[model samples]
Target: MNGDWFIRGRDGRLSVYLPTDDAVLCRAERALGGSWEPPRRLGGEQRLRPGPAVGQGADRYTHLAAWRPTKPGEAGLVHSTHFRPHLAALDWTPIGHPGKTGDRTGPPAVAVDARGRAHVFVRNQAGGVSMRMQKEKGGWDPWRDLKGGDVQGELAAVTGQSGLVELYAATPAGILHWRQEKPAAVPTLEEAMDASVRPDTLYALPTSATDTTLFHTDDSGDLCAWRPGTKPTTVLPSAGPSRVSAVRCELDGHDCTLLAQRSASGRVAFAAYPTEQESAGAWWTESGPQLPADALVSLTVDEEDRVMAATLSPSTGRLLISRRKDEPGLALEAWREV
Candidate 1:
């Protein structure tokens, strides 16, 4: 599973998309401060590695993309959408594989554009990236190749504050980026980054129209933060080598960034600091009970502006959530399995 498992919709309701052993399941809040609906199976047989990738557009429709086995040892990508925040979603639509044979494609990475178009990016069988997006007129576009030879593991994409889509892929030497010069336009390959990034650990935090801060683990297992045209800086030296889940929230009348990850000791660790102020530093706090080795944590700010962290129960496959306490500092309420 990835950090996108928990998402807040435009209507202020939150939804959890879980990739189970047999199918993709979803549970959503009925109202603000209300109970969550029982898990609803969102059709897909057999889980693919790394779970489903989700994104939401300006229209508030949450888009989901996942890989499912089409046959023995073969898989294909499929998509679905929550057309309305508190309603049933549209049926899953098949998107197929990028190559003529084999499931060598990496996990799907989704980013919906400003015009409400969902664009899915994947590392193709050729060790390069390929993209397929939704057309404005209601349909799908053919897969287009965006070349990069050494992409490894998962891919990342973000629709920036400028309303243009930017992509990042981890490689053996560093990270490679692609940017859309205009809204709804093709993203051309930008300069390649020289920071040594750990596989499947890339997270893009959009700070400005043309600037995005990328967080990943370095060769030494320390957390590093880097923005385009800037040198990579070590933020949390001991932040365990795991996928970083981050969100921007208002704390004490100031804009702050919240990050969560599985620590080296199996506990979920959290940290916060003023946005883009990594040089000033942040104090990592280990919180919650120790999770399973395969557990992935997701962070999101709720309707009340409180930070929430969620992950699946390793034994029962149930949803467990922990919200920030209503007091000073970054303390959290007890974990609640809702």
Candidate 2:
């Protein structure tokens, strides 16, 4: 769940969202755990895109957003929330395009803050970014322009270590970032952080209460980690992959970050390292069967703290879950089709 395709609630059950061509489908762990119920379709009319970006708030609510066709050749964003886990999701709310008329925008990235507000960011047609967010009174505020130029692809948003919302967008120039000085405040664009990154490959993870680490593929196609104001450090050398999904979890009692990527040939690969310790080195291991190149993959931690990986089977188109083996390093159980 690059935008957190899956989220764990206070009850410790996992809920996952999938954006098929026309609608968003959902599945959740049974209340007692051990299995997932059948897929539940969250209705939408327009043809949808890849992500139904999801973020969980302090209230334990999971907010979901996605981009869809507003009209022929026009795209718009829609959202919903899982206020009560395992229950039906709320109705879809239309978040119109940034332009007065229809306009093109990239897939959404959502971040729910400590105060329970969800901030949504998208790359505007003008190569900058625009945002629309939920209001305090339970409705949405009008789309706001957080200016930028040279922004290339999808945006990234994360609630920073201080409970403030921060955003990142890859650009030919560098990675453009925006930060809220205070909670619920408008995000201001900061100095561009330098990185020779590919568009749509940027991902952010809060490494500490005050530090955030960025993961992206460099010009050479190597995955690199960069803390703002520092040089980018290679995490995994180039393997001809374009994107990756990551999650933070405890590994062998050590705080670790796990990464999963679908290779160019459609096989899933995994790697891990101590959180924020890129200098400690890391290695990539390709495992499991090959999936469709278009198939998206995600990494998440189960309630037991074991890393779990998920993807869709190309041939059967069924959802596949691979749980981490208990004995050691990132080995996975047989791919289970649920």
Q: Which candidate is the best by TM-score?
A: 1
Query: Mind sharing the TM-score for model 1?
Result: 0.93
Please report how far candidate 2 places residue 253 from its true position, in Å.
2.2
Compare the candidates by lDDT and give the number of the best one.
1
Candidate 1 per-residue lDDT, tens place, 36-66, comes to 9888766434355446788877776788888
Error of 2 at 127 (Å): 1.9
Candidate 2 ranges beyond 4 A from true positions: 43-51, 68-75, 313-316
Worst 10 residues of 2 by lDDT: 43-52
For residues 35-92, what per-residue lDDT tens digits would candidate 2 score against the true structure?
Answer: 8888777644445666567777766688888777667777778788777657877777
| Reference-based TM-score, model 2 | 0.91
Cα displacement (angstroms), candidate 2, residue 261, comes to 1.1
Cα lDDT, model 1, residue 164: 84
lDDT of each: 0.80, 0.78
